[model samples]
Every structure is written in C-alpha cells, then in structure tokens.
Target: MIKEVGIIGLGNVGKVLATFLKANGMLYWAVSRSAADDENILRNISDIKELPSLIIIAVADKYISAVSEKLAHKFGKELEGVFVFHLSGALSRNELILCENNGAIIASAHPFQTFFVTGNYENVFVDVLEGISWGIDCKAEYFPEIEKFINKLLGKAKYLSSETLAKKAIYHASAVAVSNYLTAAITLAKKMANLADIEAEDFLLPIIKTTIKNNFSDVDFPITGPIARCDLAVVKEHLENLSVKPHLQKSYAFFGAALLELIKDEKIMSEEQIKQLEAILLQKHLY
Candidate 1:
C-alpha cells in the first residue's frame, strides 16, 4: 500500500534509488540537508509538502538515528501507517524504533552491491539492483509490503529477525572480507608482481576472473595448487621464500592451515601427508 515514496539523503545509494523511482514514474519526494550538485540527481527539496506513505532514510549510518529522531519529532504527530526505512547494511531497525512509537512502521533494506558515487548513475540505478539480494530487517507485520517493494526493484529480500540484527557486526564482517579484503588481497598481489616487473591487469586479472567464475559455477571445482596436490616440498619452499614478506607470509600460513582442514575432510591427502604439511605450516620454530 506504499503509494507515495520520500527519499532522504542524496548519497550514492540514495541517488540511485531516487533515480530509479523517478525513471519508473513512481510518485516520490526527496529531502537532503545539502543541495544536489550531481547532474544525475534531481533537485532535492528541504521538506515534504504531504508526508509520504513510505519514507526511505538513506543517510550515513551515524546519522540514521539522529535523522530518524528528527523525523519522528517533526511529523510523528500526524504520521500514521507510514513506513520508515534506511539503507544501511550494518544498522538495526531498532535505530528507528522511535518511529514505531509514533504510529509508524520501521524497516531497513540493505543492497548487497557496492555503490561508487562517481560511476554511471543510470547503470548503477538499473543494473545493480536487478535480481540482487537485499538484507531486510523489519517488523514481521511490515515484511510483506517490504518484500513487495523489493520485488518491484527486482531484488530478493532475506528477512532477518531482531536476534539476527544483533549479529549485524559479524554479518558485515563477512561482507568486508569478500569485498574489501578481496581488494586488499589484489593490491598485495599487484605489489608483489611489481617486484617482478609484471602488471597485475596483464598477468593476474584473467586468472582472478577465471578463479572467481569457477568458484561461483562449479561446486565440485577441484582446487589446483601445491596444497591440493599435497606437494609438501613446494609449500615449504613458498613458506620459506614468503617469510621475507611478513604480510604475505602470515596470509599464506593462515589460509594454508584452513586448506589443510578442507583437504583432510575430503580425504584427498593421506593422514601422514596432511601431518607433514601441517608441521611445515605451523613453523613452531617461528613462535
């Protein structure tokens, strides 16, 4: 029953969502503290003339609570059956709990994709939202309407309970591991490749893409490398050579140890071979 949509904040996600809503001929209003400088963003209004049925607060995480409080104070007196939501991946719905007390519904929708403000707004607004997974934390009563809106945007909502919301830190950590750490890992690889007078794009990118492709499409994708082959000698040589690079050495040891567990579980290596690799990886002498 979300008839009118109001968007607050004109940052990356906000811009994209607003653009999408406008393009689709959806009735919506937007408010932002600062004026919109980006040509792609429609001019933002300071306040809504008629309160919208759905209010999407897309501000930064730190400001969500403050903004929610402000909204509850400003319009809570007349706001009824209004649904207020934010687009923060790590913040809980409890941040907008005040709205619920004011006879408003509260929820949050977190798009799993990354948004770079400088990029093409049209593409990010359209392509990125299509069939993407959204992490939704909302009151049980508000779920159906939220899910409907998410479907309209071509996204699937993964509902989370309050208990799950309490674990947002861990959930966000996993996302950071895949997104941010992947970038960091590539940076390290490029730096090491620089030592060899090699360009990462020319040398590493194809391999990276292929590995990622396999990871997604192939469940039984057999891992290839010294660890998978149980080639203890090569692993020892790597450990010894990488020792000079503390960061890479530590990363190798940690991941190598984890791979040992997978190999053991799969019965791919004999117990003696696993023990030998484990000993080399442990490097008890280092401690």
Candidate 2:
C-alpha cells in the first residue's frame, strides 16, 4: 500500500531505483550531495517540502550511518512513522539504528546484483533486475512491503533472520568471491592467453559460458579442469610456465590448491592423486 518513496543518494543504485520507481508509477523524490541538471533529483534532503512514507538510503556502506544520522536530525520526530532502508549487502539494520531511535522503521534490503553503470543510464533497462534475488533483513511485519517493492522492480525477496543478517560479512564475502574474484580470475586468464598470442574472449568465452551454465545446472559437482581430472603432469607444466610471472604463478597455485581441497572428498581422484596434486600446488617454489 506504500506509494510515496524518497531516495537519499543518486549513485548507480539510486539512479536505477529512481528509474524503476518512476516507471512503476510510484511517487518519489531523490536527492544527492551535489547539484544536478535533473529536476527530479533535488540538491539536498531539506529541499523537499513534503516527506515520503518510505526513504531508501542508497549511499555507499561507509556513509549509511552518517546519512541515517542526518535524516534523524533533519526530520526529527516527523520520521516517526516513516520506513527507512539501506541497500548494503554487508551491513545489517543496525546501520540505520539512529533513524530507528528517532522513530523510523528501519531495514536492510540488498539486491544480489551488481551495478556498474557508466555514462548515460537511460539505456540501462529495468529488465536487468528481472528474476534477480534480493537479500532482505528486516522484521517479519515489514516483509510484505519490501516484497511488494522488489516485485514491482521484477525481483524476488529472500528474507534473512536477525542471526543470519548479523553474519552479513561472511554472506557478502561469498558474493565478492563469486563476482569480484571471478572477474580477477578471468583477467588473469586473459593475461595468460596474451602470452599464447590468442584473444582471451575468443578462446575462453564459449567454455566459460558452458562451464558456468553447467555449474548452475548442477551445483553439487560441476568442476572440470586439469585439477579436477587429477592430471598431475598438466598441472606441473602450468606451474612451470607461470614461473616467469610470480604473481600469476602464486594466484594459480593458491586457487589450484583450493580446488584440490574442494575435490578431495570426491571419488574422481584417488587419495594418492589428491596428495600429489596438493604437494605440487603447495610447493614453495610455486610461491
């Protein structure tokens, strides 16, 4: 039933939220620290003459607390009945406790999707959010509103208990491993491909896509590679080739060792093979 909304930041997430809210016919206001040519985006929170029922603090994690405090001060007791939420994967509802102390209902709703928009954002359609999951940490009573909000944006809401939200650091770390770390690994592969005088995308894209698709299709065990096959000779040759680039060498060795640990319980490799692969991956010379 909540129709009016406000956004406290105009970063990539904020802009996308604003666009989707407008597209969905929700009455809203948005503000940023700096001035902008967009009339819908106000210069400051104080610029608004009317307050909305819900306010999303879409600023970076570092600024969530400060921004919440500012809101607590700016609206004072008027925030008593308003709902305040932040879009930080690593932070919990505690980040907005100041606003809560001042009587605002607070929660943390993090969309499990990355936003790296540059230049014009007009072309960044809302369909990108379709079917994406949102990690929501809030009181059970407030879930319906949050779920409705996400549904409007074509996303699904996943509720997290207070205990689960408290361990958000680990949860966010998992996200970073799959997204950021995966990107780093791909970059390293591109560099390795360069050494072979081949374009990384042309050589790796198909296999990478297929691998990811297979993994998603069967998450329990979809691993494939020289390590998965327990191909000791191939692993040794890779380490030797990477010896010229110590950084890449270390990265490969570390990940190779991790992958070995992951498949140690599987029947794919014999106990002796596992130990041998581990030794090669963990050898001091590789480091």
Candidate 3:
C-alpha cells in the first residue's frame, strides 16, 4: 500500500534513489539542506504540505538520527505509524528510536553496494541494485513493508540478527576493507605503474579480472605468486623494491603476512621454506 515516498538526503545514495524512483513512475518527494546544489531535490520540508507514508533518511550515518529527529519534530503528529528508515550499513535500528517515539515505525535498509551520483540512471537500478544483498535491521513484522520497498529497486533483504547488529562496526570494517580499501589499493598500484612508465589498464586489469574470477571458483586455490610457490628469493626481491615506498611497504607486509598464513595452512610450502619466507617479510631492508 506504499504510495508516496520522501527522501531526506540528496547525497550519492539519495540522488541515485531519487533518479530511479522518478524513472520508475513512482511518486516521490526529496529534500536536502543543499537542495540548491542538486537538481534531484524537490524542496525542503518547510515547503512540503503533505508528507509521504514512507520516509527514507538516506543521509550519512552520523546525521541520520539528527535528521530523523528534526523530521519527527516537524511531522510527528501528522505522520503517525508511517515507516521511516535510513540507509547506513554500520548503524542499527536503535538510532531511529527518536522518530519511532514520535509515532513512526523506524527501520534501516542498507544496500550492500556502492553508489555514485551519475546523471543518468535509466538502467542503473537494474544494473547495480538488482540482486544486491541488503542488510535490513527491523522487527519481523516490518519485513513485508521493507521488502516491498526493496523490490522497487530489485534488491533482496536479509534481516540482520541482533548478533550481527551488535558487531556492526566489525561488519562495516569488512565492507570498507573490500570496497573502499580495494579502491585505495588500486590507486596505489596505478601510481606505482606510472612510476615504471606503464599503463595500469594494460598491465593490471587483466590479471585483476583473472584473480577475481579464480577467487569465485576456488577461494583456497586462488592464490598464485611467490608466496604460494614458496619462492623466498622472489619475495625478498619484492620486499627490497617495496622498501622505497613506506606506505606500499606496510601494505605488502601486512597482507603478505596474512597470505603466508593461508599458504602455511594449505601446506603449500615446506616448513623450512615457510620460515624463510616469514623471516624475509620480517627483515629490515632500506631502499
């Protein structure tokens, strides 16, 4: 029975949501503090006469509570029992209790995907959001409403257990490590490639694709490099070269240690070779 919808932020997620909603022929109203900067925002709350039944506070994690509180204060009496939610991966439903106290049904629906403000969203929802897993924090009773909402964007919702919510920080850290940290790692690799007068796309992208594909097929067997082969000499040479860049040096050693553990567990290297490789990683060598 969800009809009109309201989005309370116009950042990357908000903008993408607004564009998709509009394209899907859904009636939605959007507002943000910096509405002037974004064409997707309709108007601020002060200008809206009637509020929507579904309110999604797609603001940053830190500002979700404040924005929900503001909206609760402004429309608490009018929108009783309306569903209000935020799109923060790390936060729990407790953050929206203020809005719930004001008679709103508060929840969270966080899509486990990255969003960027692209001007065209014609097929972006189908391309990016479809089949994406959503971390939804709410009571069992609210899943129908939340799932229906998620269906609009073609996503699936998994109810986050209390245990998962309790460790939200750790869950979010894993996401950041793969998504944000992966991007940073790629940038660093590209910089190193430039230093060597090489194009990253020409040298790295194919191997990256192969590595990812191999990961999907056999995670335990995907690793292939000096560490996997127990080639201590090659690893030592790499460490020596990496010594010139402190950041790269640390990144390599940190992840290299983790890889060494995996290789040891798989018995890929002899005990002596493993010890040699471990010592090479721990050794101090100046560029």
Among the numbered candidates, top TM-score falls to: 2
lDDT of 3 at 140: 85
Worst 10 residues of 3 by lDDT: 278-287
Model 3: number of backbone collisions:
0
Best by lDDT: 2
lDDT of 1 by residue, 143-227 (tens): 8989998887778988986677889888778778778777767876786687667887999999899888887884664679998
lDDT of 2: 0.84
Give per-candidate clash totals.
0, 0, 0
Q: In candidate 2, which residue ranges exceed 4 Å CA deviation?
A: 25-27, 34-39, 118-120, 265-268
Task: Give all candidate RMSDs, comma-separated.
Answer: 3.9, 2.4, 2.9
Off by over 4 Å in 1: 34-49, 161-168, 217-222, 239-287
User: Against the hidden reference, what TM-scores do the models get?
Assistant: 0.77, 0.89, 0.86
Error of 2 at 207 (Å): 1.0
Q: Using TM-score, rank the candidates from best to worst.
A: 2, 3, 1
* CA-RMSD of model 2: 2.4
Model 1 C-alpha lDDT versus the unseen true structure? 0.79
